[model samples]
Target: MFNKMSIINKGILTHSFKNINRNFNKNPEIAYTIREKIPSPLYITTPIFYVNAEPHLGHLYSMLLCDIRNRWELLSGKQSYFTTGTDEHGFKVQIASIEKGYDNPKKFVDELSLTFKNLADAANVKYDRFIRTTDSDHYDTVKFFWNLLLKKKYIYKGEHSGWYSISDETFYPENAIEEKINIQTQRKMMLSKETGKEVTFEKEINYYFKLSEFYKDILKILEKKHDFIIPRSRQDELISELKKMGKLDDLSISRPSSRLQWGIPVPNDPSQTIYVWFDALLSYLTGAAYPSKKFKSKWPAIHLIGKDIIRFHCIYWIGFLKAANITLPQQVIIHGHWLSNGIKMSKSIGNVVDPIDIIKYYGIDPVRFFLSETSVLEHDGDFTEERLFDSREKLISKYSNLLMRSCGSNFDIQRALERYGKMNLSRIKMEEFPLFDKSVIEEIKQLQDELNQLAKNIGKSMENFNLHSVTNNFIRILSRSNNLFQLCEPWKLGELREHQDLVIYLSTETVRILSITMQHVIPELSNAVLDRLKVVRTRRTIEFARVGADEAYGASANRGGDHPITRITKRTSSYPDITIKHQKAS
Candidate 1:
């Protein structure tokens, strides 16, 4: 019995996966207990992207990870909502508008926002809502939230002075700023050690949030939920920061409108504007349609963000929610940055990897596969031409070649022979086949069990929001299928009259299983491969065999689809043999 279990927040099981079978004869008690639980609508969000720069590989990387998780949740029968957009309101936008020679801040942000939307579209990144901080409703939502804090006595007027970094849109204490000489200007200046950006001493009167009051409560929440942060490393970092600061300072939540004229005006005071961080963090609730009937189902959310902003999301955002009597995010998934050939990506260094360019040259699925499959989410990954080529080569030769040969397509076997000419292909073949040998059946059964186990592992990882583990499992299954293909030469097995159907059955089924799992990470490729294998729309799940095993492929004499997925001509191309060069910033 393969039970489709209903999992709540974390690993709280409303239904069990142990009794998978629908039948009652073998396990009556388990079947009776397997009542279907209403699928909870899942709300997932990415930090609204800043409109200061064009979308880069780092942006795409974060979006891709979130998009993949959302898609997987949907496939698993959960109603998932994914929201991503531009953080349009900030002092940074004002500076960008002036530099770009735009008189209207709205017009400048609109243009930059469209570029990000276009990039997401080009990459096949699916999202339910594209929210901008400048959205009209967002102003109301921010004000509503601010009023909630004020009503609860969590906000008050305050005067403060600190080292402010305009680029980071954050104020730092004296200890956080270090004196440095500007390379371009050749002048001594103070810069923030954390962000490496120039900071200026500033004083202003503004509204402040009572972050210090919630410090003890936040520590208790951390202790109660050990896995509140997706990776334990990020949780440890946040806890350490909290302990180091015996108490949190009250956070300045507004800026005087006289100095920064670009943000949302404070709820009642026209002279003051809501600070950027405070304004941007509320976009999550606004995007979820908070303070409305729809929000109840989506109050607590799962956020996916880059590791750099962990403190803001984990500490500041959580404290703000606690103060306002709002639900905190269920989980926060943090991933490391993308480096360009062992160096931090920067515009001045001119090494920022444009995901748009990568998509244009390598296609969308390949780029998604390269990023998700090759890179570890816990640590930074280097983006080099050679690494991209190496990943592409593996996909083409091992996975794609297996598909082509199994489907009896012209798979450039001569090229494959040249590449592996040294090793004897027959040595890898398994012995004794009554077509589907007892051992072969066991091996395939083992593969099926692994997929079932993956279903469980993926569920647990999603609960913890550990996408790294999910991706590694996807790669592991793909590797196992490729190994099985080598051991059983399906092309050679197709020669025998008795073994032909069984060979096709085994090969096509394996590809179908892989295709189903690949749908979330590389959807276009998954669909194309599924179409080639002729697996029906209904049979695209781990329990595919139970639903419609016979209909996995058509009875056509030529099993291959209309066109080969990977180009035979480009099969042997060298790595770093990129199809096109980066022409200009996208």
Candidate 2:
């Protein structure tokens, strides 16, 4: 019998993929298991966002996924590289530019690309490189990559005919197209069944990549690495699709320059411009300073992308790399689109959530916490004004409230850290602290052990590329610690110095460790937490997240320990609420 499993994250139902029935224990190892530290010289990336549309929550989420992974490596004291930028070449960008009446598409892409960069800055995305396809270096790289493929005889001129999507910037197989009726105009149209976007018949001569020849090579990568294409549903989709087609058709790699003049020209052949997908995919190499020694030393990158373009990234990109003899990316982490108010965001419905507007309405770190905490890694997530409001309350009430309690005037967190924080777990003798009641010591030890275990749970989840588990783990630890603090009543233990000291030390240590872990998601607020507790700037890496890791800290002058979470209400937000006019025709 097929077991119906509902995989959930933070209460978001993630097992929503249809027709994905599986037997019990078919793929058991996908469970979250503790793993070793991710090796150094790490690279992480988000797909270059296509400039056809203005920035949305979907785009912001992708950038956040990259930043979370990138910052984790940074916090762990490893050398890391991260890259995210705009995909400025393509039919979609060309049409959008003309519709806006811009005579030069470069001028058009220039404006859109800056918006993405600004958004990344506002979201605290510490990207090492922000490459634009129009960059001269990128143009050169795409040309060189194309010439290498041509020299390898993996590319050839051919006549191509298929249904094409301007929105998707790729051609669709015949089985993927569907006939649909326009809701408003009652007009019949052909649309990509996968994307629900309009597709038109196209016939042209273009350069083709032998994508079919690398089908087995790509499949072997998926089969070899079970967690390679994460969120098993996406992996199953590709595997099922591959099994359906023994081998894929050769992919068209160019468009006539006369028809699409806004892209990189084919090497030595100006009449045919390289396909935008090919040009855009080359941004990854260019973003990393490709062909330079600087790019070669890192491990394969971890790519974060939205599920809409999985085919391009997984099929075309993997095939291209296989042919080029380049190592495949460490993994392709796929996420689903965000819906607005229980409905898929649509311009016609006037319900698209402007990320900047939300950022202005809510503080940045809270927004980060909300996205990272509530995001369903495997399936679509719904975003509503109420949910955002609730998430902010959670940060302040549950987490910040605990901070105020543990570090308030009633307890000296600095004194607690200085007294007992230096003792290593293995070196400590439990019988030495006999002045306090054995039960009080026992509870304090339990909390300390629980606090220590939080890092293990969080690390394992993060190692598996599950940010939802990481953020939720933070919330769970804080909530439990808060409950224990209330029960222990450290305030009433006036004569029992050892009892009070142990309780306060473990509690404050919880906040310190939490602050370091939270830095991966909420930057400013986590920094604020550390600053309020007087945690030194140099002692905030992942190494200092344990009990005895930093004994010398917690003695500095306290800064903002009074209310602790006033950063949300008091600080001036860096983003504006200005909404961009939707350019799509109604």
Candidate 3:
């Protein structure tokens, strides 16, 4: 329900205060002439979750990835639009509702979708729009798209007889099916090797799209845009799969209304409804307000989807867009699945990891961090409490603890400064201070240089959507800062007065830089750290200038510094019943 303004314009912080030290003006603003200058909007989206069950780790992982990208865009001074929602039109949803004795599918989906919405809110997945395939606007949008494809002579009526998987809502070729017996039911059935779902021979008169026509063109796109798929391995897999197919089959775009009546109906065909996948994919366009001004710039979005659905997103999605004369997505990022301790999650096995329960037990930030940092985008990741705890322990021991201690020491220094009088040590030589080591100053200079290099690398990694590297770089800088603070022994140099000022300045400034750069991943902790330091600035920009004597002394002298929050709350501390650390120790 977020307004466009909130989604696109709210998070980019504007620096309110003037530069304290007027001497630093290395980069100046440029005056612009009207030449149709419009900043390209950053459009980020996740594949909407199917509303057949409660939100799980897989859903949360996708949402977290999108949220992280949107946050980085905001930090980079881009107008970002992030959309996530539920895919409500599917046979599974209809069956679940009926079997649960619900009188109406709408009522059932409405209540269930709210749980997802609530979970999103609880996890701080701030999306621009929570689009549902069942929305009135979406129905019109899907119908319009279908008609356009028909007008282009791409859609046609055809009788399809094939092995269909009701669970996957997909038709499998004969070679793709394997005969298997249900373990519990002990009945012979045909299963799809790709999806591990039972398939049956079904015949139906359905509407189909000429997906075969786009094979060569899709190959050309893949050849030209090497980065169309995030990891090269996935792209190669897609190309290999496509090449092996030889020729594409015309994809069925609708199901008989008698079989699936809960979806958007084909225009002028009450006897047929749009296929669930087709109906769901168009949610992106509807959420972007397609065929309108808003759609013009953001037509092609960056789609973050799971690797399992790569065929639907990369292949079928592209064909639809090309037929409609719409620009294809800028990029498609395919992430791997989350295995529960190396085992595939299944309801029958009772191994599905509930994300909400993780949030409730260990707090929200830990869950977000674990999923994003631990997973390898190209392969499956094992989600274990032990891994989560280890990640938490590292973040706390290295980053959070450093921030708290630095701020605490700075507070003490500020208190002492207020009790005595103002001290400006801008022009004083490092060696002039009592008991000051020249090596420490050299080390600080080296740290400044390292920060500059790391800042650039982090920016590049983010542009490439290398979040794991971005996070690793940030942590490296933090670990360096912590090392510097420990080596300098800032607290022990309190009696040296000038030496104490130097140590406090270096340590607190390191914390300040971390507070600014780490804001995208950990907003709450960053805000608290920034509050204590009183070093407010625009989030759009990152500067790594060496702290000059004047700037450091001025920040220390300012009364704006105050104790904001004394300590950061750990995710594990609140949930004593949850043994996130015990497993790690074992």
Least accurate 10 contiguous residues by lDDT in model 3: 27-36
Per-residue alpha-carbon lDDT of candidate 1 for residues 1-586, written as tens digits (9 for 90 to 100)? 0134334522333223333243334632233223233444678888899998789888898788878888888777667888898899889999889999999999999999999999899889899889999998898889888887787789999898998888888888776789998778899999987778999999989899999898998878877788788677778877877887778888888889998899999977999989999999999989877654345445578898898898789889999887765667888888889877666777765777778877877778878878886556578978886666666666667666657656675232223323332432223334534655566656665665675456667767766555557667766666776677666666665355334444444455556666776688888887887777666687675455221233525334244454334642233322232223433422
- Please report, in order, the local distance difference test score of every candidate based on alpha carbons: 0.72, 0.76, 0.72
lDDT of 2: 0.76
Which ten-residue region of model 2 has the weakest summed lDDT?
27-36
In the range 1-586, model 2's lDDT, one tens digit per residue, is 0012223321222231111122113421111111113232667889998898789999999999888877887787666788899999988789899999999999999999999998998888888889898899998778767877887789999899999888777788888899989989999999998888899999999999999898888888777789888888789888988888778889999998888999998988998989998988878888766544334444367888888888888999998877776667888888988976566777776778888877876878888888988878787888876677778888888777877777656566666666777665334445765554555456566667766776667667776668888877788778877876777787886566665666677777888898988798998988887887778899898888887677665553333346655544433322212233333432
- For 153-189, candidate 3 gives per-residue lDDT tens digits of 9999999999998899988777778998877899998
Off by over 4 Å in 2: 1-40, 183-186, 422-443, 556-561, 567-586
Q: What TM-score against the true fold does each predicted structure earn?
A: 0.83, 0.86, 0.83
**2 or 3, greater by TM-score:** 2
Point to the candidate with the largest lDDT: 2
TM-score, candidate number 3: 0.83
- Deviating ranges (above 4 Å) for candidate 3: 1-37, 181-188, 409-442, 495-498, 537-586
Give me the overall lDDT of model 1.
0.72
Cα misplacement distance, residue 265 of candidate 3 (Å): 0.8
